[model samples]
Target: MKIFEAMAGLMTDLTAIGKDQKNVQQGFKYRGIDQVYNALHPLLAKHKIFTTPEVLDKTREERTNAKGTVLAFVTMRIKYTFWTDDGSSVSCTVEGEGMDSGDKASNKAMAIAHKYALLQTFCIPTEDMDDPDAQVHEIAPRAKPRVSDQQVEQLRKALTVAGMDEAQWCASVKIPSLESLPEEKFGGAMDYIKKAALAA
Candidate 1:
C-alpha cells in the first residue's frame, strides 16, 4: 500500500472502534485524529517509509433539496509526498470525493485516496526530511457522523434482517449473546437468521 493509504487504513481501523457513545461529541467523537496519528507512528517505523499527505484542493459541489436540508459534496485534492528506504522520494496527487462539502468520508475513503495519491513514482533524497523544526501533523480528523446515505440505505436491508428497525435493537430482541454462541454455530445460525427475516 502507499504511505498515504497505510496511514489512512490505520486511521480507519481506529475510528471504527470509537463508534460508541464514549467517543461521541457534536455528532462526532473528539480527538480521533490524534488517536489515528499516534497509531501511525509504529506503523511508519515498521514500513521504513515516510510521507507527507496534505489537503491540496477543496471545493464544495452540492445541491440543496426542497426540504431545506443541504446535501453537499466535497472534492478534496490530496498531495502525498513519499520517501523510500534507499534515499528516494516522490510526490503524488489524489482526489477524495465525499458526500458533501462538510460531510467527512469514511476512514476507507481516506485510505483509498492516499493510495491513489502515492501511485505515482519518482525519486528524492531521504536527507531532505532532515529539518528538525518540521513537524508532521499526523492525525485523523475528529470523529464525526459522516456515514453516507448510500451506506445507510444498504444497511437498512441488513438492519431489517437483524430486527433492528429501532435503534435500540439490543432491548427489542433477546437472542443468545454472540459470545455465548459457539464459534461453529456462526455459519448455520447466520444462514438461518437470513432466511427467517421478516418483511419490513
Candidate 2:
C-alpha cells in the first residue's frame, strides 16, 4: 500500500477504546502498543500483509528552542515492518519522534505518536523493484483515536472479570462494573449464572 493508502486504511477502520471521546463523557486516553498492533492486524490479514514491531534506538538530551525554552526531550524510534503473505519483500519502515512537555497535552501527543507511526508505515507506498527512487515520504498530522462503543463494553467486561470480587458473586450479588452500564458482557456474571442453574 502507498503511504496515504495505509494511513487512510487505518483511519477508515481503526478501533480503540478511551482514545478519544470529545463526543462523550467516558472519553479518555488509552495508550498501549498492543492496541495499535491489533488495529492493524485485521487489515494486514485481509490484504495478505503482516507486521513485526521492534524498538530501534533511544536518546535523551536537553533541547532548547529559539524562544529560550529548555526541556528534557525523549525521542523513541519504533519500527513497524510490513510484510506480504508470499514473502516477496514488501514493507514500509518509518521513524517517528515522541515528545513530552510534562503536561496533559503531552499525554495526547504521545498517543498520536503511536497513531502517526502506524499510519506512516501504512502510507509508505509500494514501488517497482527496479525503481530505486520510489521511497515514500512524510505527510501531515492526525487527530486523536476514535473508539467504538462495542470496544468500550468489551474493555469494561475484561477489567471487571480480571478484578472481580468472588465473595460478592457467591452471595449472588450484581456487579455493575465501574460504570454500572450492564452486567451482560461481564464473564463473572456468567459464572454466577451457571452456578445458579446447576443449583436448580
TM-score, predicted candidate 1 vs. hidden true structure: 0.31
- How would you encode candidate 2's per-residue C-alpha lDDT over 138-164 as one tens digit per residue? 878764343346644554454355564
Q: Superposing all C-alpha atoms, what RMSD in Å does each candidate have to the true structure?
A: 17.6, 22.0
Error of 2 at 19 (Å): 9.1
List candidate 1 segments past 4 Å from native.
Answer: 1-44, 65-68, 84-88, 101-112, 118-200
Candidate 2 lowest-lDDT run of ten:
123-132
Please report, as a residue range, the 10-residue window in candidate 1 with the lowest summed lDDT: 119-128
- lDDT tens digits, residues 28-120, model 1? 432233443454456556665688788877776667767776766666777877665665655777886655325554343465566444322
Clash pairs of candidate 2? Answer: 2-125, 3-123, 3-124, 3-125
* CA shift of 199, model 1, Å: 70
